[model samples]
Target chain A: MIERIESFRRRRPRLLEERVTLAHGAGGKASAALVDAVFVEAFRNPLLEPLCDGAVIDLPGGERLVISTDSFVVQPRTFPGGSIGQLAVHGTANDLAVSGAVPQWISAAFVLEEGFPIAELKQIAADMAAAAAETGVQIVTGDTKVVPKGAADGVFVTTTGVGVIPAGRDLSARSVRPGDKVLLSGSMGDHGMAVMLARGDLAIEADIRSDTASVSPLVESLLAAAPSTRWLRDATRGGVGTVCNELAQACGLGVLLDEEKLPVRPMVAGACELLGIDPLYVANEGKIVAVVAAEETEAAIAALRSHPLGADAAEVGEILEEPAQTVVVRTGFGGTRIVDMLVGDPLPRIC
Target chain B: MIERIESFRRRRPRLLEERVTLAHGAGGKASAALVDAVFVEAFRNPLLEPLCDGAVIDLPGGERLVISTDSFVVQPRTFPGGSIGQLAVHGTANDLAVSGAVPQWISAAFVLEEGFPIAELKQIAADMAAAAAETGVQIVTGDTKVVPKGAADGVFVTTTGVGVIPAGRDLSARSVRPGDKVLLSGSMGDHGMAVMLARGDLAIEADIRSDTASVSPLVESLLAAAPSTRWLRDATRGGVGTVCNELAQACGLGVLLDEEKLPVRPMVAGACELLGIDPLYVANEGKIVAVVAAEETEAAIAALRSHPLGADAAEVGEILEEPAQTVVVRTGFGGTRIVDMLVGDPLPRIC
Candidate 1:
């Protein structure tokens, strides 16, 4: 390996601006060059220097902070609709958003399962940089670790984000009340279904795609309009059922869902039915479930509908006082059954 | 999968506490039970209950904070001197120590390559819990991700540590001065050589053991005595050569090492000679390189020698201004040659 690097140093090519290579993931000269030329060059800032393993940021205003870390193991490395790179940025931003914090900094750690193509890694890095810029967050620090071929499956990313919540903003599952209305931001189960369809037995491609996105700004606006928004959860792993169940556990209340009023795309619904999977147990990367005071339901829904990613927003259910700790879904056949928390992750590795 | 869990739930015996099976890493019922009955039972703390991806702790006093992350992927999983679990703890804690930080909370994430023996996993977890207790640092939160068989090599551990340093106690590479003395906390390259010997490559066994340990207390003592300590770096990946070269670059100074004065165990020396690798480039998990003011050189050495992990501490060399940014090793024959950083890692996956 040292001999190879020595040979490269002797050549010292002039085409400094090109796609990345495996050497970039190596913690050596080539890797340093890659960082200097691409990530740091594009996202020029004092914070990203001679980068530290992690960044030390002082809150602009002294307040309790929000911190989140997520790891993305999305297979295929790159897929239709979105790549793992974009998913990392959006996933982290959404974490901060739901916590009612305006995210300020992010740390990206890439674990490249060896044999992953360099061009693809570079593309992923570029996507991450662009996504960070778009979301108004700084990719302040990063660490790259490369495992030998076969030790890792493909490319896995672990991103850590820090955000600051404005003082006086109270958002928690504990704050949710029995009469609060549940508002879902956009179509459900698109993200997980898209990835599954992209990977497996789907003979025909569908219009449905992963609705992965950053919702910090959208969340801020909604919370601003409806300060009484009791609770918010990004419908991620285990989909709506998981978040609702956690909320139920948190608030000590039950939820009753009107299945006829729930929004599900035809393609997603059909795919779930064919796969013998319940859409409720699937995951969604961008959709969020907001439990708000009934008086502010309209304003919350309006805020969600205004965002492009939330156009299909709808009021699906409301918190209930009776049937403690159980979620009953009212079906179109005048029958009702429990909408329990997902037993386990059915659509595994959706993130 | 859900049925499997339900069956386990219905017929569950009193917490399968004795033998471990593959299900422990399966992210299912067994895994959750393992965490509950064992890890939680042993390391129970309120901060760990939330079970976020990692722990978020606010430093007690208002001072600059230090944070670091490391991954441990060792072959044979456990060896003569250390296990992957111990390495994970020492690797991350040392990162904090060398950075002039008083290590605090740590988050340990495990990625188990499938088919890892359950007994081995339990032992590894026990090793980690014990190590954390010894160091007085809490493993506040954790995550476990399981990959199918052949997806990972045994189990890989990634730990992130957060520490805090007093505001004025700055330790920087550039702080090294012309007359500064360099100190080693312990014997060099034992970790690498021990692992190499354990790899079953030699006609004769080398009685080497890994110097894997936490260097925080040692570093603190050294700093306390030599309050004007210029810099500190763990002699780990890429070893002494890489660290010296890095210091030269950052400090804009040259470092000259008297090869005769440098310390290396005879067993390790024989192994390095046999493998045609330089001991200077071999890794050390517990050892540290401290650059201290010449006036406090004796005090620093005494400080180091007091720590159990630093009984073999020695002053190896001194910082010099001639030919700034170069590392020269003085051979016994009165000849000198540049000791450059290993361009790429000499032993791939050595860590």
Candidate 2:
């Protein structure tokens, strides 16, 4: 772990930007740079050194705790199939779930614009309550603050979730081995496409709904079937491509994706094509990417397919021994292309 | 506990406004009404029924954990004595401290507006690191999101803190008895006045600084000296007056404050007078109001006085057996007046 931290420090690039841009929050290279250079350096500690979706801590009493925090700023507040309230709860809970923990409690804080509608706020709160109930977590504490009219958009929610990791259930990206297979749950780009269409900024339309649901159930089934799972992550923000890059960087290895095996809904693919965006780099809220031992690949796919949220789960990629710290895709056209972490924003505030 | 919950439900007023107002976030009557009517009712559960600053959970392992969340949206980002970064850490940590817990870990979520300066962000993060270090807490996990320029203020931070409750420590507002004495740690309104002055909206100026420091040390010393302490709360948001009102409402009793005994810095008092606001209803970050058994009043004051942050510790009030749910102040002019929870926005975004 010390060596990993040292390597991470060595790889961090110097930040030269004088001002923040949309790229800084795009969950791509700029976001990673900001977090690595500013936050990780300032709050350096062993518990945070992993740079995992959630921070894991071992209590003096032998209890393992996982905690994660996320702030939701999706545009329009209301989007197809979901609202910020539901997304906020699922977002934090999914982080814990991916870390091999069962989310138990959550704290929500809301920042509201002065003239925002109270009815909308109540509806958002209701959505949050419903999501918490379905996710089997309790909203135990919260805070609310209001800014002047122009100081904020309609509403923003920040949720922090606490979960407990079961014994013998240690999963991490660093555990990835040479022949690990990457399994993805469901299709890609549905969430980002739905939110973009909901904004009505584009003339083109599609029958897409944001796949914004808690992935805990799918995670539990997968882990139960494939006990040797190396790593798991919810493909949010910068989507599957970004998550793959992170996994490769953490393990000091490379990843190879078979484009023919990737899952994508027709509507999402069309929308991405029309917008000149790659579905692989779009955000996802309900989907997860899992790396499992090659021997357990069939069992992992079977377990995920049995879950309702993972009906489309498939083996999409494999971990590579060569070209350390890079991600390459084997295109259907019999060619290979390097897929790097997203550099600029094609769609902002999608999640 | 059921009866308390029932009473809370009975007293909650209907929310009639169609839109949220600045007063709704002023940490006063409107804020309480919105929380009770919207959040409490939606997220109703036993753990959140008490409406304490932090929620205390008893783990199956015989360990007690307390969690609290707060959002800081103070205007200007930087203020006299502290930046929003420092205030964010202190605010959440203080919540856990007042709940008789030792703050151990914190998670921060930042929402940054596009085009914000990177240097300012670095300074803010540094301030947060300093505050966390001073309070002996670790920032283990965090997330960041960026919004367009007009969508949000410069920076808004939401922090969630987790702490552990020591063995045999059970402090609660419901434990307040009629004869319990109230002890204040330090001066009131310093933080509020300082922030307001820093905004430069008023021509009147004074050498006042925000008292935005963690109150954990003061709480520890007071609890050590007064083992029978009933309740502890920081004077934030709606200030000491609102805290007293909440105590009276929670315990079904009355609070009697001696105006002359309340500690107020000369500058803060003068500024409040000029602004036509009462110091008792203004905010303070580093101050605490403690409810202790009558017999331990002197010991509690002595313990507080020994701490640098609590040098102005004094016995300012006592619990009353009559006039349930009322807070009255006995003025130096030999008259008594009801000190109701603030009704309007005398100070918005003061925290």
Highest-DockQ candidate: 2
User: What is the C-alpha DockQ of each candidate?
Assistant: 0.04, 0.60
Error of 1 at B211 (Å): 1.7
Candidate 1 lDDT for residue A55? 27
RMSD of candidate 2 to the truth, in angstroms, is 2.3
Please give the range of 10 consecutive residues that has the lowest summed lDDT in model 1 chain B.
B1-10
lDDT of 2 at B277: 94
How high is the CA lDDT of each candidate model? 0.68, 0.87
Please give the lDDT score at residue B60 for candidate 1.
30
What residue pairs clash in candidate 2, if any at all?
Answer: none
Second chain only: TM-score per model? 0.81, 0.96
- Fraction of reference contacts reproduced per prediction? 0.06, 0.71
The worst-scoring run of ten residues by lDDT in candidate 1 chain A lies at A1-10
Give lDDT tens digits, candidate 1, residues A52-119: 21122233235545555666767655666888898889887787788787876665655556555545
- Candidate 2 ranges beyond 4 A from true positions: A1-10, A45-53, B1-10, B45-54
Query: What is the per-residue lDDT of model 1 for residues B181-270, given as tens digits with 9 covering 90 to 100?
Result: 888887778988887777785675867888888888899899989999988889887678767876776677889887887789999888
